[model samples]
Target: MRKGFLLAVALVAFLFPSGAGAAEKVWSNSVPDSVWSDGANWVPAGVPASVDHVVIGRSKTIVGITNAAFAGGLLLSPDVSLDIRAGHNLTLGSGDAAVNIELEGNAEIRTVGASALAFDAVNRLNLNVPSSARLKLGKMSAPAAVHQSGGIVQLTGTVTAAAGGTDWHVNGGLLYVKKNDAFSGNMTVKVAAGKEVQFEKGADAGASFDFSAGSSITSLDVADATSAVPALKLKALTGDVILKLINVPATLAPGDVLRVIDCDSPIPAAAQVRLDPASAAKYEIQLSGDRRSVMIGTRAVASADVVVFTPPTDTLASREYEPGVPFAASFDVTSSAGQALTVTTIPGSSLPVWLGYVVTPKGGASSDVTVTLSGTPDATVSGDIPLGFRASTATASADMTYTIVKKGSGGAPGPNPNPRPGQPGPLPRPNPGDPLLPDPNRKSRSGGGGCDAGLAGIVALLALLPLRSRRRK
Candidate 1:
């Protein structure tokens, strides 16, 4: 009995199978109107529901959705098109199942009014807008990734991505986000060499792209064109963003300004918008005074001709310096056309401990500036000491080396020829008439009357004087 029951069950299962009732509903357009809710428009005689995969194979058939509808999947044949009429919506995927929508050979999906193609967060949407096809929508909530190889996708309304993240690839196409539209997603764009990704604004007043919801853009490609340069505006950058330049035209010239990004809010100090090295070499990148825009000017604008007025030398001793005397040397740097100039001490080229310096007009858009090196060297400092400095303008830079030399403690102290009132005077001169006192100015004789001889002579003279007095008496 058990074996008979098993055989009957297997026969029934084989006949029924799984998903055998699902059908691919092709558009036949048998009805008078293009209403998608009409049962006569789709072959197999009924409107497509959750169990049906909708295929628009007719080259120019326009299907209109009057109300909310569901489909297992949607596919547009080459040169075919699908339109979700205004005030209506069509949803792909039933329940938790995933839906795949492929557009091949210049097909398009255009939506109007409040109409939209909806997908559940649990549903994966595989949408391909490739090669001359277009996808224009007012609003779209992308639950899964959207891949575009070489077509255009214009969003005039908000497109929000699920928390799981969405990767948008614009391989060789244009993705234009219109003014004031908010596109929030963890989107990584990989644009081809000649492709473009633009975020535009109507009046440059409000934010063009809002990533404030923690959405991030890993990489973006911008074109090097005189017109239609890629510009983006953000409230704030909460993640790393990189800007790359593509399609560098051969007609690029000096002094040309390429406006790249515009933002309403100040970019965080820690957030850096980096450019590729090759592009950086060809252009001068700078932030606006408000720190809200990134501007790129041709290298020519920054390449001012810098002229150094101070002659180049290896020695800092421009003038003779006494050991304890103050020393000063000035170097003047100016740019062509009076462009701004900057003078600074080169890194690792600091002045000696005994020396100090100051740069006049510290830094600004000044045509000329001076760098003065001054110091007082004591007797202890001597010999040559290395010193270096760099002078630069927006486009030009020059480096110079000057050394300090300390002459020995200015020769020993010389006698003060003219003594001050309180200081000691030279020795007193001897009187010419006094035979007893020898003159210091003249050299002494070999046997001149010394101290003892002089005293004895005085005594003898006194004794003789007494003898003479007695004889006279």
Candidate 2:
């Protein structure tokens, strides 16, 4: 029986010697290059079968692979692109074999036996994963851009945006959403401290940027995104990084914050964090004491520092000053930090040009600045102009209004407009009419009402004369 089995094996080998072992196929090198699957385009004179090991060679353009599966391994080239058509599954890195492949095109490319895939070389991989396709990236250096022009990025293992200046753009599809489950690219990125990462919008319109719970990123840039709720709730655990929150809403869902925590960042301690209110107001950015996040609002809206965004009010409250007639307005400023505060006028603000103003005591609360329109103001200036000044240590600013009154329109020095509520009025001129609006006192025989009394007596005497004349006649 042994002799008969050996003879059968020998006969089978003699019948199909090449079929026993698989062949290696290389792309065609001749002019007028042919397609990848063409039988005449391979070095072995025939296209590779499912069992043959394949290596994609350099081409003027990308080559297409339309096969179900490969039993052997594949060696992909960095210079060339290999596209696996839809409905076809292409495998690489089998039996400890590996290749350097940068995924492009709109088809699916994944490993069959390999569990992990590491990408490298400052990848500009513009890969699209349709619902029928998924991606598996191993733990490695982050790519320049993980653009989801379309499709699912199946996280087989932890991925990291671990380098400097990395960008992850999302146009459509879910990035592994299953509640508070925090992972890289889902809600956070496992990046080195101070590494810059930008979250931006792409072709998919009406799509808002969403950052998950426990998000960790360094040097974030979300200036190009607009979110429905708090777009990012990342902990500054990544470091105290300077970030721009443009188009970010003031509050998310009534109380949620855009930035949840600011811890571990490399940002240094500052006496005050100055806010550019023009940009902040456009994006609705505000910060509360409870919420250390950048764009979050507090339960008490007034508790937050939104004075920068508030418009200027009447600084000279109820007080009117005429031009060339020196008058002063006092502003009592309070600081959040009891630290000594320094006050200065903001440049480009409505600073007094025609009117000379001086801030007194330059420090501490209950401080008053005297603004007097001592010079001749422009003839056209007659309304309230806003004067902006900021406190250094307190990080607070005031928008006070100054009225540039016409020459002498203000009534002659009446009672102070801002007098105390119960303060007494000016002394009255003794008269039966209104005590106010009384005639000025004159030095004559009688103080006042003497004219009325004398006039009444003369009128009575004149009436008596008319009666006496009539008796004599």
Candidate 3:
């Protein structure tokens, strides 16, 4: 029985030797020319007839692999642009074999295989596929650097993704989302050293994106539902940094630390933090205070300083010079500081007589005149100024004194030149010609003694009578 089995195996090997050898040579020399023109699709230039099964040679472009998949596996060479349009699906067969399409220049590929589409040097690779295509990257010998400059990984169909289990790097490039389409899935989306990935409009807002110092993402605006109206989410990966907040609102969650060094005055009143649900693992909400020591989870931090602004109080009060007062207007001033206060007037307008004084005006007159307070007197400022008027008409001479009194106390500023509830008029000015105006003293008449005719004639007759009496005697 052993001899019979050995004979059968020998016969089988003899019959299938050529068939078995054909499959092995399929990958050998699979590389094409430097450039593959549209001759007939993957059918290399010169394939020997005696070889029977053609092998993929080095530095060759494998054009149409539709039939090549049925025949055997296809091998792609490096520094070669593999241009595959839509509806071209290339598959990798069993035994853990690998196929690679090198995109040296501009190239489009619809890949569905265990193998990967590698960009050896700086190159643009466009992967256009139908419904979400999944390709797994086993391991990277070196870093898989994809330089997609002016090349687009377009998804003409519905939701699609390109996920990498291993490290997949994108050096200086863009992940452009075409209009009316969406790209989703968990992707590291690494930005290589000194490279960036800018996400423009129509790009997914919630893309699990991070950035390097030399790299950045652009046109990334937040959803309208968030408290941060049209804000940005910067995935912090480095040490202490100050993220500038422009026209965007900022909200802090519990366990989130933020530092504000120097800020301009008059901070917006609407500045506050709101809890974010998407990142709930951190905390609910965190609000900063004024210079107070607080904690955002384990982060020991302090709040920003609050500034209070005050306006000028000079317009409400004023002062002027009076004759009797020293060099200052006799005005009253008090202090709520519970200490003696000093009032100073505008420089150059300082009084020459009194250094400082409080003058209270009272009367039924226009109250629009500017009233000022000046003085160093340290009591509850309340007092009056005496108004004395002397009349010197063509006939009479008389002096009138009127008390200019203040009704309220405690320096309650009020009616000057006008009479208060208890005070008289702001000492009335003496009238000369008006007879209806009464004189405070009854002894002094209105006119002077110059027009006393009767008294003068009586004096002359009395003088003559005295003379006649003297002669007769």
Candidate 4:
């Protein structure tokens, strides 16, 4: 029985062979041409099928994909290169399993024309472009998790999002988006120390990173390097760009300048550049004369103190005042740096003709001062009247608004002269006898005197008269 079992196992092994399962195919370059479809160019003497793992190891030769191809995974060894030729496609992975494409040691993969690389699996496409690798592709579609550490990836076409996941971690690399191509995923650019990532226009005059597709970067860290050129250069901006300064030297003295961004075209009015609040506190940030570059003056000292104005709690015109009555309200004003402040009403925000304000001191030059708003609102001014006050020093100023709401006659709130569209107007005071309105003098039917009461009276009268007619019938 043991000999029979051994003979059967041997027969099965001989028929099936170990090579029947998935195998790895290495690029041998045995043929004179570099076509990937040529079986003679790969080891094992056959083209790689969907169940094969392909590798290009330590070859300077550029392997070309002239036709549609499939592979379970692909790896490029140091200095090896590959290209998907024009109009060709390369599909990676099979079934519902995850696959990987690793480019390391300066390996490169460039796609020409409309050629594309796609991943065909439910699981993620793990792409690692590290160690100075370069990947320039027209487009890539997959549920991808891309990690780049010290490499460059220039994407000229869109990277469509998938259900599995699509994210990018650019730890120390440049991920350039060309020609308004959109990346439909979140990208975090946390460049390593001593490194910088730049966003610059491509060959197209209108090229820009298209963040309008709901894609956004967490933040950009700008080092205080003295590069004459701006770290971020573009012709125009389409979305908000947030920046935080990093590696600021402790020895940086006040007034030292740092250049950050440059725009060849005028920045869109809707676009904004948000700077870190902490960085803004320590630097005087402004754009150049032509609005081409952004400069930061380190630790700029304020020339003069700023005045702080504190309005009353009822600053929003919530409280109603009686017309033609003496109204008085007071607010305090102080200086931020304890310097003397001057208080005055803003030029165009003068109080209404019947209202006036008086500062505590005649000259209005004091560190801590009070402004009193005292006036009898004119009977004709039976609505909200806004008053403005400004506290200022030599270099800085602050303004506050005080609104006075005057009630109309009979203690009713005054009507808005210019009510906005869709705003409900005052309720109509219906006449006492209006048919559409309920009569205040009328009694409820349940309490009698309505239709119910009249019906009951008729029924009572019929009962008292006895049902003689009905009985006769």
* Every candidate's lDDT: 0.59, 0.41, 0.31, 0.60
RMSD of each: 17.9, 16.9, 22.2, 24.0
Give candidate 1 regions above 4 Å deviation: 1-21, 30-33, 144-150, 163-174, 184-196, 201-230, 234-284, 288-293, 296-473
Question: How well does candidate 3 score on lDDT at residue 451?
Answer: 38
Q: How accurate is candidate 3 locally (lDDT)?
A: 0.31
TM-score per model over all chains: 0.45, 0.34, 0.29, 0.41
In candidate 4 the C-alpha lDDT for residue 255 amounts to 54
The best candidate by TM-score is 1
Report the error of model 2 at residue 22, Å. Answer: 13
Query: What would the TM-score be for candidate 4 when compared with the true structure?
Result: 0.41
For residues 107-163, write the lDDT of model 4, one tens digit per residue.
Answer: 877777888888776365555678468777677775555555556776776565555
Name the candidate that leads on lDDT: 4
Native-to-model Cα distance after best TM-score fit, residue 121 in candidate 3, in Å: 23
Predicted candidate 1 versus true structure: per-residue lDDT over 382-411, tens digit per residue:
656667777776666767655454443122
User: Which residue pairs in candidate 1 collide?
Assistant: 302-395, 303-395, 316-403
Better of 1 and 4 by TM-score: 1
Better of 1 and 3 by TM-score: 1
Model 4 misplacement above 4 A:
1-20, 30-33, 147-150, 163-165, 171-174, 184-198, 202-473
Superposition-based RMSD of candidate 1 using all C-alpha atoms, in angstroms:
17.9
Residues 1-473 of candidate 3 have per-residue lDDT tens digits of 64753454344335324333332222223445322222233333332222122223334354433322222222222333333323333232222222222232332333333223222221222222212222222211211223333233443232223333222244434444332323233333454444433333233322233334432433322222233222322222221111222211244554434331112122223323222343333333233354211112222333232111111131112222233432222222222222222222333343323233343322334211122434343233335433332222222222322222223321222233212368664445345444577433222322553333246778888889988988999
